[model samples]
Target: MRFLSPDFNFWIWLQHLDTPDNNLNIPFEFTEANMRQVKEILSHYPSNYKQSAVIALLDLAQQQHGGWLPVAAMNKIAQILGVPNIRVYEVATFYSMFNRQKVGKYHFLVCGTTPCMLRGARDIEQALLEHLKVKRNEVTKDALFSVGEMECMGCCVNAPMIAVADYTKGAEGFTYNYYEDLTPKRVVEIVEMLRRGETPPVGPQDSSRIRSGPSGGNTTLLSDPKPPPFRDLASC
Candidate 1:
């Protein structure tokens, strides 16, 4: 269930320095258009509380920087928000959603909490890693895919689920889609679809089911219920 260990901070720091795809040495600033968006985001908060937009700005920065936030990008966000650099770093590190290092163009986050685990989440993870020929958090040689583990994504009814973040189309075309109720074979087929630049349908993989409804069709509420009883308050 735990994706990060106690030494995660140290590991992430090392990655910042050593990861070739993430050039931490380079400077990062918001684009002119992104800056305009930043201004719009800041507008939602009072001028005195611009710092409250830290998380939102960090997300924008990540999107602009190709799906991960480098040290430079975090620093730039701190500067823009007028807060200490550590504040931005804290937010980024605390949230699993923020990737400190580089990820593949298609990053798969498999839910591994109790519900998902009991439903074959581990198998899904293994299938993805094996088929992609990459370990958890490691990008494939083609830079098209990577796999990671996540806690419950609130789709327990669907159980075994994955959330895919597609960065192939850049920030403007970025998409985060969820695929739920999967078997090992089905999940791998979804990956192959991505490899072929095809978008597999999102949500439950089982054709017989819809959304999180019962797999064998509704067992209850098959017919409309009688109208609610009404009291004559005026007469009383």
Candidate 2:
């Protein structure tokens, strides 16, 4: 549920650092203005307790740099928040939703949680490892896909979910995005497309077989229309 931490003063320092201006250690996409905006978002909370903004700030950095967080970016976030760099790393590492290493342009994290497992997530994981021709915790040759198994994604009703596309490009092509409600074939197709640098639609896949409710049918009941009656207010 959580994503990033926030910082203010340190971010400014990071911007003014001797190193050439950069974004996520990639090229510069997030400008100083962007960091200021992130700071504004963090300012809503006390500066000492600014870690609350970690999730949001991570998201902000990811968005700024095309979707992944580099060590530099994390350090900047740490400095801005006035917290130790390790604190930011701890948060980034603690959440399954955050990415420490490089990932594919469309990172696919298969959920192996109980609810997801009950719905056949193992096949999903195998499918990714096999389809992408990459092992768990390894990046593909194209640098466009890293498939790993993850914990619950909090969508039990959907079951068998995947977290995809947390990032766009870094050491890995993309990192930190999550996708849910999928089948092995569906995930494979999406990854293949991403390998070609294409975007795939997200959310509950367009499959009639998925069904709805117990019977896989609509539940709205129909009723007959009644005749309208006109009421006339006469003398009191």
Candidate 3:
């Protein structure tokens, strides 16, 4: 709840949108097998309240769409679930994870959060812009890349992390690639590899031992557990 800050008037706004005569009855352009898979996703829930399956359905649709969710695909979801199309749109827009516009072969998402910024994510972002000739919210001319600045992506240890969502690399090799301890040079190299239709392994493609360990590395994980639940409560 703390992270979900969506406007509450979405339903009201939907009713007012001038719908195309065929809008309400539109169907998803999915394959018969995919449709079956979607229905099965719903079978896990109890009964008619299909809205409960919206998340999984949308996610499946997104994967079907190669990481981005299309408006019509969203509409299809609404129709299949018997919910308002606007409702699906509402869900799509509220989640940053869903991409509305078509993303590049690789969605170059740079984290601009505190730790990343401190670690040089800005440098990496600037490098991406300069090297790829694109800016935040803009896709490359070649359509091979798109730049996006997002919040903490849980790579604080490897601050300056970027999640590559190369739509070209369909469902297998890597769903997501996190680049950590990035530099302008490193970022450029990664993009160049991507532009050439290659997935240059996940982290710093260079020879640096940045994430390796605190021999000054990029990988840092907490060593000690904070203690089981209230195990230390008595000490308080």
Instruction: Please report the candidate that would top lDDT against the real structure.
Output: 1
Show the colliding residue pairs in model 3. Answer: 105-166, 105-167, 106-166, 210-217, 210-218, 211-218, 211-219, 213-217
lDDT of 3 by residue, 112-147 (tens): 788888888778888887887765655678777887
Better of 2 and 3 by lDDT: 3
| Candidate 3 displacement at residue 121 in angstroms | 1.6
The TM-scores, one per candidate, come to 0.82, 0.64, 0.73
Badly placed stretches (over 4 Å) of model 3 are 1-28, 171-174, 204-236
lDDT of 3 at 169: 52
TM-score of candidate 1 against the unseen true structure: 0.82
Model 2 lDDT on a 0 to 1 scale: 0.66
Model 2: per-residue Cα lDDT over 1-236, one tens digit each: 11111343224322333333333555323577776788698879987788888877876776666545667878878877888888887887677566555556566777877877877787888888898787675567876677655677777667778877545544244444445567788878877777676767665664553543322554564466576986665843
In model 3, what lDDT does residue 1 have? 23
> Candidate 2's error at 141, in angstroms?
2.3
lDDT of 3 at 151: 82
Ten residues in sequence with the least summed lDDT for candidate 2: 1-10
Stretches > 4 Å off in candidate 1 = 1-10, 13-24, 210-236
Output the TM-score of candidate 2: 0.64
